[model samples]
Target: MITMVRNVSRWFKVNRFMGKCTVIGVLLAFVAVACLGQLASVQLLNGKSTAQAATASRTKTVTISAKRGKILDTNGAVLAQSVERYNVVADPELAQTFVPTDCKEKTAGNCQQIDGQPVGTTGAAAVARLLAPILGMDAKELGALLSGTGQYVVLKKEVTPEVMRSIDDLGLNGCVYGELSSERLYSNGTLMGALLGGVNDEGAGVAGIEQMQNAVLTGTDGYKKYERGGEGVEIPGTVTESKDAVDGSDVELTIDANVDWYVKKVLSDAKEQYKADWAIAVVQDVQNGQILALEDTDQYEAGSDDAKLNTSRAVSQTFEPGSIGKVFSMAGMLQSGAHQLTDQFTVPGTITKNGQTFKDATQHGDEHWTLAGILEQSSNVGMVMAGENFSNEQRYEFLSKFGIGQDGLGLPGESDGVLTSAASWDGRTQNTVLFGQGYATNALQVTNAIATIANKGVKQQQSIIKSVTDANGHTEDAKTGEPTRVIDEQVASQMMNAMESSAEHYSKFAGVDGYRVAAKSGTAEVAGSDGRLTSIISDWSGIIPADNPRFVVTVVMKDPQGSYGGLTSGPVFKQISEFLMQKYEVPASTPRTDAIAVTW
Candidate 1:
């Protein structure tokens, strides 16, 4: 019985131990399965989101500024350009953590030490102390900027590359950096100042050509996305995305800088000598209608506030063209077969027609003059008689064809001038229109009108921009419309012959040596600042080497000391024509053999 009882006790003890082992194994299996499930969830289901959160903490995006294009003259001279600059930027939050290291050995760049001792300051104060001298700022002011809690702050803007390099040499451990930027620089101070225009603080064009071609001059900005370390340092091989900026296209103008400078100087001198309110001048290539030089007296320094505010007077101001209108009317007469240049007329000093009395500049007895002679003498009565057969519609039609009161150059703030319908003309205005009093036009219109006669009756589109070269170096010439024939070629020749005779009348005052000029002068009464019809506008337009025209020059002055256009503006014409001839090496004029008789 004792052996049986001992065996039962041993068996029961063995079973209980096995049962405990089994329970422990089952618990261990359950714990292992829970750990595997947790590991899968972390590695597969939520891994991407967790990794994205980590990247968001360290990644940063920065702007890469596009370089603005340059404005160049036809001769490849730089008129306006962008100079490389930088904006000194700082991370105020990071700057506040800046700490200088103590110098143990006297080695350069080994430690942040001032005068062979440790920098005795910490955080933003230490940064400010090192940066203030280089930046030319007060240490206290810089410290305040750096003590802010913002991540980004502009320390100084438009710093030169030299200054930026010096700042970089300090090695501020990523607390400060330079953002690439540029400054628009006009190399020639006040040359074409108001016309070239200026940029705003944000580098956008606000006036003149800068505003007109803003799209061509502006570029697309790019960006860079990368990871940075805790110290604001970009991590190696962590740049995830980046795109390079596209620089703006370079614009080349049709103007010659040297000629423009000379024209401006001449206009300025004339404005002072004549004691006039203002003066304007324009020169154009007759063959292609490309404007060579356009200038006015109200010049301002480029990049100045005045440059931003003022419009170009050459294309903006309007006035009666005075007797310069004779060329258009005479062209009309010859074109419509109303009269021939050789036709005879006995013109008195004054005459009345259609209840309107007209007079010449000077009183004279009855003179036997041909149509050509009538024009040479610039007789208002002669034009009235010549236009006896010229219907009002014919008058308006000819003026329209000649581009009077028309849009010119399409420049900013350009005026199209005023030309009322023929139906609006009164009896006095109808006769006055025949002599250039009833309509108003700008200087450019007058210039191109005469240019049409010089171009053998063909009118070419005027162009200021010569070409555009894009960032990829692809070049394209400025687009323009096709030339139009304004009149028969024979009629243009007759007008040119008549104009040559008129030019001789002003030869003493406006003649260019060795060049035959086809010229006309005009003096008109315009409204002054007080809106009184007392102001005098004296103007002269001429084509040099008339037989083979190359350049057409025009000069206009307001309220000049000398009232007559031929007397006041004539000499200016001579000076500019002389320069054009000498500079271009133009051949001297051939003797006139086909000259028509002015007296019948």
Candidate 2:
């Protein structure tokens, strides 16, 4: 019976083995047919698709961003710079393609589980949702990104470690970190915000010197080419080409940090102390027209609704300079060659021209004031009496010559200022303008006017840049705007003498202090709705260590806690000039041993 059972078992096993062989035969035949069909399609029917796929396999490329250039103050202190950052990337396609080995606990089919929750916040719909919060993104947005069909996708371009940790919790698949270029911080926050400007993510300059010299500041990008495998990792021995990045040039500015800081500090304080709406300050070298320090912090801060820095006023604000305009008025008259400093005028405490009533700040009845005294006390009437020398046409010409209508500062949104043609002038315009009331001017114009005076009647259009260096460190003197001399040297010296006299009295320089301090102070009632003076704006301009004058500085305080220009703007000027004197070790221009020459 056992023999019979064994025979039956063997027979059954043979039958089962035969059945398996038959099934294997059929499958092999079908696979052979499919392989032949694919071969035929590639060899003859439509080989273009195969060729394109192969070519694509050979063209993988990578990018390396160049580092950003440096920004330094005139003294070479770093202001803004660049550093390396990272971008996170993921291969969702690879996550789908991977397969696990027998020993591997994480397998291709269930790799999504290893990927944890997707980056998106939408619980089930997203691959990136899990990473959204850590990366500072909306789950819905990340989900949409992951659900897309791209072979490669940027998960996050800029991220912190705090963000990376959150992504790790997600257990995402095919996640990778890549390097990117970014801006480094400035130790000095907002110190020269307007001047230095900031960079965009793509490293493009938006304003100021940064924008002006972008080509030199931006470095060349590098490239890498390699054959990518099916999983998108580089194939071994497949790198064909690479080009290293060229670093950008380091830039240096002529701006002095200390000087800029001082200017900002004093002007910011004055603006607050005076409750003034705006303030502007400038310090420039007389030997060459390099602006050392320039600030317009108050108006912008007030507009910002905080003490924080914002809105640049230096190159922006334009208003009627009021009596402060007298500094130029005196210069223009002197430049016209018809005026002298000793010229005496019997200012009857007022002067009437074209039915306009012009009076001094306080009435000093019918007293003789020299051209020097008129400017010293900032007398509006006294200037009108002395202004008889230059014709209206000559006055306008002189104003234009000194860069009133065309300083060519070339600042964005720069104004031509308000100088209507004198030919269209009314009695009110002429008289009010005579004492610096009718015309409007910009901060640049005011500084440029005094700059012209400091430059000995030469209108050296003000510039802040010293030189622009190329990527190779070759520097070309910045494209300099031409200087137009508005007055003869002799006349300029005379007018400077008058200014010196005025400065001495206002500053209480008891005797001829060795320093040739040439200065002028102005206070004009800010004309309200009636087109007449009622309130006030105070301003001051001067040059110090007068002989071989080194610095020409202009400080203006608007609607200060006090009323007069001398009181509101004077102290700021003193502090600034004193600092500069000590910094530069400026000695007084030898005390005047004899009579000094001046023009009205």
Candidate 3:
């Protein structure tokens, strides 16, 4: 019995020990299963989100600026262009977290001992000290910039690519970077400054041709997005997204840079020689109305504040056309069958009719004059007498057809010169209109008006831009409508003959030796700075090689010492006409056998 009881006790003790082992095994199994679930949750269910979070901490995005297009002259000379440059930028937050490695033996990394001296500091201070010399910035100021909480700051702008490379070699990890940028460069300085216009701080066109062609001149910006390492440097092969920038299309103007340069010089010299307040000149191709050169005395440097403030005066300012109006009126008289170029008149120095008195520029006795002589002498009284048969509606019809008071060239700040309807004309204004005193017009209008006769009574739309070429090499010519007929072809020839005799009047001072110029001169009294008629606008318009017209040149001067247009602006007309003939190798005029009888 005792042996059996002992056996039972032993068995029960063994079973209890086995039960404790089983319980511990079950607990261990439960813990392993729990760990497995947690591992699955972390490695599978939330893995993508976790990885994205880690990347978010180091990812960086940078803007890549597109290069702006160029403005080219007719000869493909660069007028305005963009030069590649860089803006040195910094992640101030990253710079503030930077810690340099200790220099025990010297390694290929930034070290605490910069320039062989223990940098006595950490974080932003150490970075600024190393970068100060390279960037030519004060260490203290640089440190202040790097210590800011902002993610990005521009340390310097418009640095050359060479300088940008030097900064990159310093390797402040990802704390410093270079952002692609550009600087606008005007190669010709103030040559066509106000006309070429300028860009703003953000590289947008604000005036002149730059503003007019902003859509073609401005390029779309791009971006670069990538992941960076803890050192703030882009990891190898980590560029996640990027787009190459599309450069802007190039604009080619009709202006010949050489011609424009010469014209500007001539005008500048004339402006000083005459002691004029300002001067403007325009040269147009009679066939196409392409403006070869447009210049003014108040030129400003491109990309300058003056360029922003001032506009091209050639299309902006207006003045009474004076005797230049005689040509239009004479054309009207001939076109309307009111008078013949040979019709005789005894023009007195002054005349009074309808309670209005009119006089010539110089006091003179009665002179025998024909219609052609009246124009050559720019006789206001003769015009009044010749226009006696011209009705008011016919007077307005001719002026309107000649493009007076019309929108010009579409340049910025261009004005449609003032011209009241003929029905509104008073007695004096009626006579004044016949000789070019009661209305106003700009230089371009005067140029085109003469060009109308040169082009056989057809009017061509004026164009400054010649063509546009895109990045892929496609080109589009400038758009212009068909020419409009303003006068009969035969009438234009008759007027040209009459003008040939008129130009002879300026032979002493304004004649081009080889070219037969059909020209007219005008002098008008305008309001001065004091609002009185103390200022004089002297203007001359000439069609060169009158027998076979090629170019029309118009010159205008304000407050000139030489008060007469024939004296002040006429010489300028000669110089420009000679240049055009020589440059284009135009043949000399055939003898003027078709000259109209100036005196019958």
Task: Look at candidate 1 and tell me the lDDT of residue 71.
Answer: 96
RMSD values, in order shown = 6.8, 6.6, 5.7
**Residue-level lDDT tens digits of model 3 in 321-400:** 89998999899998899998989999999999789888899999999998999998889899999988999999999998
Q: Please provide, for model 2 over 1-600, each residue's C-alpha lDDT reduced to its tens digit, 9 standing for 90 to 100.
A: 999999999999999999999999999999999999989988778788788789676567888878777877788787677756567676655534333222135553433332443222222244444455567778667656555575567877766555555555444433333456464556565565665555555677655556666777888999988886554656778778899988787777768989988888888787887788777887888867778887876332111122122335676665666666676777777666666677766678877776777788897787767777778777888878877776778667666666665644564445677777889878677767767766667666777777777777787757766665656678766667677777778777877777777777666521223456777777776665577776577777788866778887877766787777777777788878888888888765776654443322
The C-alpha stretches of model 3 lying farther than 4 A from their native spots are 1-45, 100-105, 108-120
The 0-to-1 C-alpha lDDT of every candidate, in the order given, reads 0.90, 0.68, 0.89
Instruction: State model 3's lDDT.
Output: 0.89
Per-residue lDDT, model 1, residue 412, is 84
- How high a TM-score does candidate 1 get? 0.90
Candidate 1 lDDT, 1-600, residue by residue in tens = 999999999999999999999999999999999999988988899899888999998898999999888999999999999899999999998889888777665646646765666779999999998888889999999999999887899999999999999888777888999999999999888888888899998899998889888899999989999998987889999999999999999999999999989999998998899999999999999999999998999868888899999988998999898998999998998899899999999888898877878899889998888888888988988888888889999999999999998887888888899999999999888888887899999999999999999999998888889999999999999998789999888998988998899999989999888889998899999998899998999999999889999999999999999888888888998998899999999999998888788887
Q: What is the descending lDDT order?
A: 1, 3, 2
Give the clashing pairs for model 1: none
Model 1 CA deviation exceeding 4 Å by range: 1-47, 102-107, 110-119
